[model samples]
Target: MNATRIGAGDRPRLYVSTTDTTDVTGDLDYIAIEHAINGEPVSLTTAEKVYTAQLLDSRGLTPTAIGRLIGSDPVTIRGWKTNGWQPAPTGRPHKASEAGRERAA
Candidate 1:
């Protein structure tokens, strides 16, 4: 089993892996069994809530106004603005940029 953390600055990501095939397969099988036995509901995190709020407020207001209302920094709100000022639908929607679409293709 191996676990690694990678990222820079305040944003960091975690990656976990197992070299042993049996261990990996067992882990996945266990996860599937657990989910089947006891299903769990998905919930939103604080950051997601904040982003949603900001997006909602921006619908009828400027980015600065939305940022102020949601207690988010202007720069972060600006980045979200560049991605199209549309509220995300229920569940995760594809909010891809031009470059992202190109790369995906």
Candidate 2:
């Protein structure tokens, strides 16, 4: 059997900002990026998060699809989508964007 391995080239290079908004190379989990920075006050900025969400919304995709499209974790995409601004729903796996996705395909 041939085993597939993810080398350094296959992994994503994440850059978390410092107190002055400078990019620093690090491998922080995609989902915890906002918590690490915002919770700890590490140069607070929502530019990337918001931008990613906008792209996903414009493309009419769910967090899973957008995550795959941008090489980000699906949970992180969901985090950006429902981040503090949006209201949470009780139902699981919301299909609000699913219809649009089918149309796009």
Candidate 3:
């Protein structure tokens, strides 16, 4: 699909809601995709995966196809779709961390 320009205000925005892989994949290089596939740093992996899934989904790719691209299972991809592909929380701050911050302030 083509990008649509919205808003009648001074600053009109170009919104792309496409089913074309080229429109999505063209902006990403091989190295960036490789980094996401590697699941490095641990913390950002979930977000990376979810974001990639959303991009591929917008490009008219199937869950199975997205899973294949990202080295994940189709079931997991389906779950992402069910839950809106939101990344889970990584972890919580340490106990007393808020108190410590207040004291510092």
Candidate 4:
């Protein structure tokens, strides 16, 4: 027997199979449940900050080159060149104490 399991959104499907010729003593055909284990979301702000940092570190690339590579605005790149930015916080949140952000600078 063959079984297929679907997941939410654009997640990948899971497949399983069993046969009497195979290990029949165990669970036969099983429909494995699929879910977003350790689900997390990306922050576009963080992505922009990371991309800007990478562009700054590339050394050889001009603003236009970096913008084309990342499909962003050259004006944005120019702004980043002047006013640095930080990546947006990920969905995971923690207390300031837990994150060690409360310590004296």
TM-score of each candidate structure, all chains considered together = 0.28, 0.31, 0.43, 0.31
Top candidate by lDDT = 3
| RMSD score of candidate 4 (Å) | 17.1
Local lDDT at 41 for model 2:
21
Taking all chains together, the TM-score of candidate 1 against the true structure is 0.28
lDDT of 3 by residue, 8-70 (tens): 346433222334322344553434444443332222245556767777788688888777667
- Best model number under TM-score: 3
Pick out the ten consecutive residues of candidate 3 with the lowest summed lDDT: 13-22
Per residue, candidate 2 scores C-alpha lDDT tens digits across 51-77 of 544544564777666554445567766
Candidate 2 achieves a global lDDT of 0.48
Against the reference, the lDDT scores of all candidates come to 0.42, 0.48, 0.59, 0.42
Clash number for candidate 2 = 0
Cα lDDT tens digits, model 1, 1-105, are 975543224533211222332233342332222222222122333344244444354446655654544455666666655656433345855566966988989
Stretches of candidate 3 above 4 Å error? 1-31, 34-44, 88-105
Better by lDDT, candidate 3 or 2: 3
Model 1, position 35, has a per-residue lDDT of 22
